[model samples]
Target: MKHLLTIFKYALLLALSGVLMWYAVRGQDLSTIGHYIRSANYFWLGITMFLSVLGYFSRAYRWKMQLTASHQTVSYWNVYHAMMVGYLANIVLPRMGEVIRCSVLRRTSGVPVEVSLGTVITERVIDVLVLALLLGVVLMLEFNKFWAFIESLFVDKYDSLAANRDVLLSVAGIAVLLAFVFGYLLLRNLDKLRENALFVKVIAFVKGLLAGVFSIRKMENKSLFLFHTGFTWLVYYLMDYLAFMCFPETYSLDMKAGLAVLTFGAFGMAAPVSGGIGVFHVLVQSTLLVYGISKEAGIAYALVVHGAQTMLVVLMGGISFIVSAIHSGKPAAQKQMSVSR
Candidate 1:
C-alpha cells in the first residue's frame, strides 16, 4: 500500500508537469521555437555548462564543510557522488532526492540519516533566504518592468483570500486553539511518552537533527564557506547571463536582466515538479516577456538552457551513481570473500 501510494504521488506530479507544459507551449509555433534553438550560439552554452560543473563542485564542497562541522568525516568524493546521485534522482522525482542523498551518505560515510536530513533542511532554509533576498532586490530595481506581472500572479488569489478573510480567520483561530490544546496534552503526557520506544527514537532523531542544523556555527573556515556560497550563486547568475548570448533575442540583455532571470528562474526550479520542467519554462518565458522578448524566443532560450543543464546532471549523475555503487559494493564483496575463506 505504501509503494502504491508513492507511485500514485509521482504519477500525479508527472501529470501536473505535463499539463503545465502543455499550457506553456499551447499557442506557440513549434517550428519557430525550433529555429531559434537551432540558431543559438552553442559555444556560450558549452561555457555555461562548464560553469554549471564548477557550481556543482562548489556546492558539494560547501555541503562537505557542513558535514565536517557536524563532526562527520565524510570524504569529498563521497559527498559529491551522493549529491550528484541526488540531483539525478530529482530529475525523475521532485524533492525525493533530499532523502535519497541523505540515505546515500549514510550508506557510504556512516553519517546518521537524521543528521544529514537536518543539514539538508538547513541548506534549504539558507537557499530560500538567499532567493528571497534576490527576488526583493530584483523587484525593487525593476519595479516598473515586473510589478504588473507580479501583481497579475497574486492579485486574483489575494482577492479571493480577502473575500474569505473572515472564514479564514476563524479557521486559523481554530487551528491555533487545537494546536495549543494538543501541545498541552503532549506536555502533560511527556513522561509516559518518554517511556515509549517510538518516542525515544523520535527524541534521538530530533537531537541529531538539531546537532546537524547547528553545525554551521561550529564551522572552522566560515569565510571559505561563505565564499563558496557566493561563488555558487555567481556561477548560477553567469549561467543565465551567458546563456543570454546564445540567442539574438536575449543577447542584448544586461546584467540586471540576468539577475532577474536567476531570481525568478530559481523560484521556478524550486517548484515541486520533476527537474522543474514545465514551471521553469513557463516562468522564464513570462519573465523574458517583461523584457520585451516574444514568447516564442523566450521559450526557445529556456528550452536550450534548461535542456543543457538537465543533460549535464544526467551525464554527471549517471557516472556518480555507477562509481558510488561500485565503491559501496566493495565492502560487501570483501566480506563475502572473507566468510568463504
Candidate 2:
C-alpha cells in the first residue's frame, strides 16, 4: 500500500515537471529547442553520466563506512544497487527512498528493514546539516541577491512575514507540544505490547541499524568518509555545471550561478513537490534569472537540465535494479551473506 502511494507520488512529480517544461518552452517553438539540442555537446552528456555513476559509487563506499561496525562489508556493487534503487524511489516521492531501497536490501542482503530505515534517517541529518552550512556560506556572500530572490516569490502587496512572526511562533509552540504528547503515548503503547516474537526481532533489528549509523564511532580513518563525501558532491556540482553548458544562454554565468542552481535544486527536492516536479523547474529558472539570464532562456535551460538529469537517474537506476536481480539469484552467495546477517 505504501509502495503504491509512492508510485503515485513519483508519477505526479513527472507530470508536474512536464507541465512546467511545457510552460517554460511555450514561448519558443520546437525548432528552437531542436536547434539547442543539436548544438549541445553530446560529449558533455556522456561525461555527466559518468560523474553521476561515480556519485553512486561514492554513496556505496560511504555507506560501507557507516556499516563497518558490524564487521561486515558488502561489495560495492551491492551498495550501488541499494543507492540507485533508493534514488529511483526518491525521484517519485520527496524522500520515500528509505523504504523502497531498504526493503530491497532487507530481502536480498539480510539487512534488517527497520535498521535500514534508521540509517537513512541518520543519513538525512548529515545531508541536511552539510547543505545548511554550504547554503549559509553561499548566501552570506550574496545576501542581497539571495534575499531579494526570496522576496520575489511572494505577492508584493499582501505578504507580511515579519508582521506575523508572533502568531507563527505561537502556532509553532502548540504544534511541538502536541507532537510530544502524541509521541509519549505512542511509545507507551509499544511498551505495553510484547506478545509477538517477530516484533521483538524487529526491535532488535532497529537497534542494529542505529548501531550501523554509530559505527563511524571509530575515527581511526575519517579520511575515507571525507573522500567519499567530497567525491559525491564533486559529481553533483559538475553535473549541475555541465547541464548549464547545454544551453548557450547560461554558459556565461559564473561559478556562483552554478552553485546557486545546485543549492536551489537541493531545496526543491526536499519539498513535497511530487518528486521535485514543478518545484525544480521553478527553482532553477528563478536562480538563473538572478544571474542576469532572461526569463525565457532561464526557463529553457532549467527544463533541459532537469530532463537530462532525470533521464540519467532513471537509466542508471534501471541498470542497477537489473544487476541486483541477477545477484539475488545465486543461492550460495545468499547463504554466505545470510551468516553475516
Candidate 3:
C-alpha cells in the first residue's frame, strides 16, 4: 500500500510537471531557444556550475552543525555524502530526498533515523522561513512595479467574493460560533482530553519535533550556524546572478532582476515536481518576461541554469554514492568474516 501511494504521488507530480512544461513552451519558437543556448557564454556557465558544488558543500556543513547540536557526532565526509545522495534522490524522487538523507546518515553514522529526520525537518522549516523572509524583501523593493500585476491576481477573486458576500458572511458567522463552543468545551474537558490515548501519543510526537526545531537555540556555535545559513543564501544568489551573464540577451538584467527571479525560482523548486523540472522553467521565464525579456531568451536561460545545476548534482552525487559504498561496505564485510571465523 505504501509503495502504491508513493508511485501514485510521483505520477501525479510528473503529470503536473508535463502540463506546466507544455504551457511554458506552447507558443515559443524552439529554434530561437536553441540558438540562444548555443550562443551562451560557457565562461559564466562554468562558474555557475562551480558555485553549484560550493552550495552543496555549504549546505552539508550546515547540516553537520545541526546534527552536532543534537549530540550526534558524524563525520564531515559522511554528511557531505548524505547531502549528495539526497540531491541525487531529489532529481529522481522529488521530496523523498529528505527521507533518503536521513537513511544515509543513519547507516553511515549510527544515528537514529527518527532523530536524523527531526533535524532534517527542522532544516526544511528554517529554509522555508528564510525564503519567505527573502521574498518579503524582494516584494518590498519591487512593490511599486508589481502593484498592478499583483492586484490583477486578486481583483477577480475579490469580485467573486463580493458577489456572494451575504452567503459568505453567514458561513463565517456560524464558523465563529462553532469555534467558540468547541473552544469552551475543550477547555472544560482538558483533563479528559489529556487522558485520550491517541491525543497523548500525538502530543509526545509533537514535543519531540518541537525539541528538534528548537535545537538551534541550544547550539554551542550559533554564530557559525548563522554564518553558514547566510553564506549559503549568498552563494545561491550568486548562482542565479552569474547565470544572467551567460547570454548577451540576459546580460543586461541587473541584480534586482536576479533577486526577483531567484525568489520565484525558489518557489518553483519548492513545488512537488521532481527537481523543479518544469515549474522552474515557467516561473523563471515568467519573471524574465516581467523584465521585458523575450520568451525564447527566458527559455534558453532556464535551460542553461537548471541543466547545469542538475548535472552538477548528478555528477557529484554519483561519485559520493560510490565512495560511500566502498567506505561503508568494507567494515561490515570484515566484521561478518570475523564473526564466521
Candidate 4:
C-alpha cells in the first residue's frame, strides 16, 4: 500500500506537469519558438551553464561550512559530490534529492542521516530567508507595477465573488466540510500511523535533524557563511540575466526585469515537479509577457534558459555520482590491500 501511494503521488505530479506544459504551449507559434531556439547565441548559453556550476559550487561550500560548525570533518569534495547527486535526483523525484544527498554523506563520512538532514533543513531555512529578502526588495522597487499585475490576475474573480452570496456560501460550506473530514480521518488513523515503521524512522530522523539545525549557533567564520550565501544568489541572478542576452527579443531587458523574472521563476521551481519542467516555463513566460515581451519570445526564452539549466543538472549530477562512488570505495580498497600484504 505504501508503494502504491508513492506511485500514485508521482503519477499525479507528472499529470499536473503535463497539464501545465500544455497551458504554456497553448496559442504560441511553434515555428517561431523553434526558430528562436535555433538562432539563439550559444555564447551566452555557455556562460549561463558556467554560472550554474558556480552556484552549485558555492552551495556545496556553504554546506561544508555548516557541517564544520556541527564538528563534522567531511571534505569539501565529498560534500560537493553529495550535493550534485541530490540535484540529479531532483530532476526525477522533486524533493527526494535531499535524502539522496544526506545518504551519500552518511555512507562516505559516517555522519548520521538525521544529522545531515538537520543541516539541510538549516540551509533551506537560510535560503528561504534570503529569497524572501530579495523578493521584498524587488517588490519595493516595482510596487505599483506588481500590484497592477496581481490585480489583473485575480481582481475580476474577486469582484464576481463579492456579487454572488450563494456561490460564496457554497464554497465556504465545502471548505468546512473538507476540514471536518480531514480531522476525522486523522483522528481515526492516528494510532496505526504512529506504529508504522516508516513513522518510527521519521521520528528518529526529526530528532537528529533538530541537533543539526542548532549547530548553526556554533559555526566558525560567520562572515564567510554570509558571503557564500549572498554570492550563491548573485550567481543565480547572473545566470538568468545572461540568458536574456541570447535572444534579441529580450535584449532591451535590464537587471530589474531579470530580477522580477527570477523571483517568479523561483516560485515555479519550488513546486513539486521534476526539475519544474512545465511549471517553470509557464510561470516564466507569464512573467515575461507582463513585461511587454511577446508570447513567442517568452516561450523561446523559457525553453532555452530553463531547459539548458535542467540539462546541466542532469549531466553534472551523473558525473558527480560516479565520482562519489569511486571516492567512497577507496577506504575499503586500501584496507583490502593491507590485509593481502
Candidate 5:
C-alpha cells in the first residue's frame, strides 16, 4: 500500500508538472524554443558535460580514498564505474546510490559491502559540510533585498509550493533526527533493545553500519579528500551554471546567479522523488523565474540544464563501465581493495 501510494503520488506530480509546463508554455512558440535550444551554445554544453562527468569520477576517487585500501590507489577506473552505476541507480530511486555504489565496489574489490557503504556516509558527511558551507556563503552574500522573494518562498504560508517545500524539509530533518536518536539509544542499551532475535539483529546491523562509516580509522588522507571534494563541488557548479546558455532567456544571467541556481538546484534535487524528476524541474524553473525569467523560459532552462547533466553522467558512466570491464580483469567482488601505498 505504501509503495502504491508513492507511485500514485509521483504520477500525480508528473501530471502536475506536465500541466504547468503546458500552461507556462501556453502562447509560446515551441519552434522558437526549439530554435533557442538548437542555437544554444553547444560549446558550453560540451564543457558542462565534460565537467559534470569528470566531477562524478572525482567523487569516486574520493570514495576510494576514504576506503584507505592497501591495494587500490584510488583507481579512477574502478571509481568511475561504481560512480556510474550509482548515478544510474539514482536516476530511478532516491539516494539509492550509496548502497548500490557500495555493492558495486564490494563485488569488484572483495570489500565488505556494509563497510564500503559506511565510508560512503563519511564521504557524504564531507559533501554535506561543504554544501552547507557554500550555501551559507551564498546566503550571506546574496541575502540582501534580492533574496526577499526566495526567502518568502520559504516563509509564506499561503503559497502551496512554498509551504510544501518547507514542510518537506522539516519533515526530513525530523526523520533523520529520529533515526539518529533511535540508533544512539539502541546502541547504548543493546541488552534492553535486544528483547528478541530481531531486535538483536537490528542492533548488530546498526553497529556494523557505525563501524563501516568509521572504516578509515587512522588513515590520514586529507590531501586526496580535499582534491576530490573540491573537484566534485566545482564540477557541480560548472555543470549547473554553464548549462544556462542552453536556454534563450537565461543567456545573460550573471555568474553569481548561476551559483545561486546551483545552490537552489541542490535543495531541489534533495527530494525523495523519482530521479528528482518533478523536484528538479520545479526547483530549476522556480529559481530562474525568481530572477525574472518567464515560467516558459524557466522550464526550458530546467530541461536543458538537467538533460545536459543527464547526458554527461550517462555517457561517461557508460564509457566507464566498458573500460572497467575490458581493461580491469578484477571481478568487482573482492572485499579488500589493493591500495597503491
Candidate 6:
C-alpha cells in the first residue's frame, strides 16, 4: 500500500508538470523557439556548465566541513559522490534525494542517517534564508518594475484570505487549542512514553539530528565555511549572468536582470517537481516577460539554459552513481571472501 501511494504521488506530480509545460508553450510557435535555441552561443553555455561544476564541488566541500564539525570523518570524494548520486535521484523523484543521499553516505562513510538528515535540514534552512535575502534585494532594487507582477501573483490569494478572515481565525484558535491539549497529554504520559522502545529510538534519533544541526557552531574555521557558501552562490549568479550572452534577445540585459533571474529561477527550481521540469521554465519565462522579452524568446532562453544544466547533472551524476556503486560493492565482496576463507 505504501509503495502504491508513492507511485500515485509521482504520477500525479508528473501529470502536473506536463500540464504546466503545455500551458507555458500553448500559443507559441515551436519552430521559432527551436530556432532561438539553435542559434544560441554554445560557448557561453559551456562556460556556465564549467561554473556549475565548480559550484557543485564547493557545495560538497561545505557539506564535508559540516560533517567533520559533527565529528564524522568522511572523505571528500565520498561526500561528493553521495551528493551527486542524490542529485541524480532527484531527477527521478522530487525530495527523495535528501534521504537517498544520506543513505548513500551511510553506506560509504558509516555516518548515521539521522545525523546526516539533520545536517540536510540545516543546509536547506540556510539556503532558504539566502534565497529570501536575494529576493528581498531584487525587490528593493527593482520595486517599480516588479511590484505589479509580484502583487498580481499574490493579491488574489490575499484577498481570498481576507474574505474568509472570521473562519480562518476560528480555525487558528481551534488549532492552538488542539496543540495545547496534545502537549498537556504528552507531558502527563511522558514517563510511560519514555519506556516505549519506539519512543526511546525516536529520542536517540532526534538527539543525533540536533547534534548534526548544531555542528555548524562547533566548526573550527567558520570563516572558510562562509567563504564557500558565498562562492557557491556567486558561481550560481555568474552562471545566470553569463548565459545572457547566449542569445541576442537577452544579451543586452544588465547585472540587475541577472540577479532577478537568479532569484526567481531559484524559487522555480525549489518547487516540488522532478528537476523543476515545467515549473522552472514557466516561472523564468514569466519573469523575463516583465523585462519586455516576448514569451517565445523567454521560453527559448529558459529551454536552453535549463537543458544545458540538466544535461550537465545527468552526465556528472551518472558518473558518480557508477563510481559509488563500484566503490560500495568492494566492501561487501571482501566480507564475503573473508567468510568463505
Reference-based TM-score of each model: 0.96, 0.81, 0.84, 0.84, 0.75, 0.96
lDDT of 1 by residue, 1-341 (tens): 99999999999998988898888889889999999998999999999999999999999999999999999887999999999999999999999999998888887777888899888888888899999999999989999999999999999999999999999999999999999999999999999999999999999999999988888999999999989989999999999999999999999999999999999899889998999999999999999999999999999988999999999999999999988876774444665799999
TM-score of 2: 0.81
Best by lDDT: 1
Q: Which ten-residue region of model 3 has the weakest summed lDDT?
A: 326-335
RMSD of each: 2.3, 4.0, 4.1, 4.8, 5.9, 2.1
Better of 2 and 5 by TM-score: 2
- Please give me the total number of clashing residue pairs in predicted model 2: 1
The regions of model 6 sitting more than 4 angstroms off are 329-341
User: Judged by lDDT against the true structure, how good is candidate 3?
Assistant: 0.85
Report the lDDT tens digits of candidate 2 across residue range 1-341: 99998678667767776787566666666676566666776677778878887787788778766655445555656766877888877776656777887777665576656656666676677788877876887798778888988677665633676678899889999999999999998688886655668888767877877775666675357887878877887788888888776667777777777788888888876766556767777787778778887766666666666677778879888887887777664544768799999
lDDT of 5 by residue, 54-160 (tens): 77667777777666642334455566687787777776656786688766766555556666777778777776787788778777867773477556676556566
Question: Stretches of candidate 3 above 4 Å error?
Answer: 152-208, 327-341
Better of 3 and 4 by lDDT: 4
Clashes of each: 0, 1, 0, 0, 18, 0
Residue 185, candidate 4: alpha-carbon lDDT: 95
lDDT at position 318, candidate 6 = 92
Which pairs of residues have clashing backbones in candidate 2?
10-92
lDDT of 1: 0.92
- What tens digits encode model 4's per-residue C-alpha lDDT throughout 57-148? 99999999888887787889899999999999988898999999998887777678788888999998988887788789878987877887
Off by over 4 Å in 2: 1-34, 154-191, 194-202, 273-275, 329-341
**Deviation in angstroms for 286 in model 3?**
0.7
Error of 4 at 144 (Å): 2.3
Residue 177's lDDT within candidate 4 is 100
Report lDDT (CA) for all predictions: 0.92, 0.73, 0.85, 0.87, 0.70, 0.91
Q: Show the colliding residue pairs in model 6.
A: none
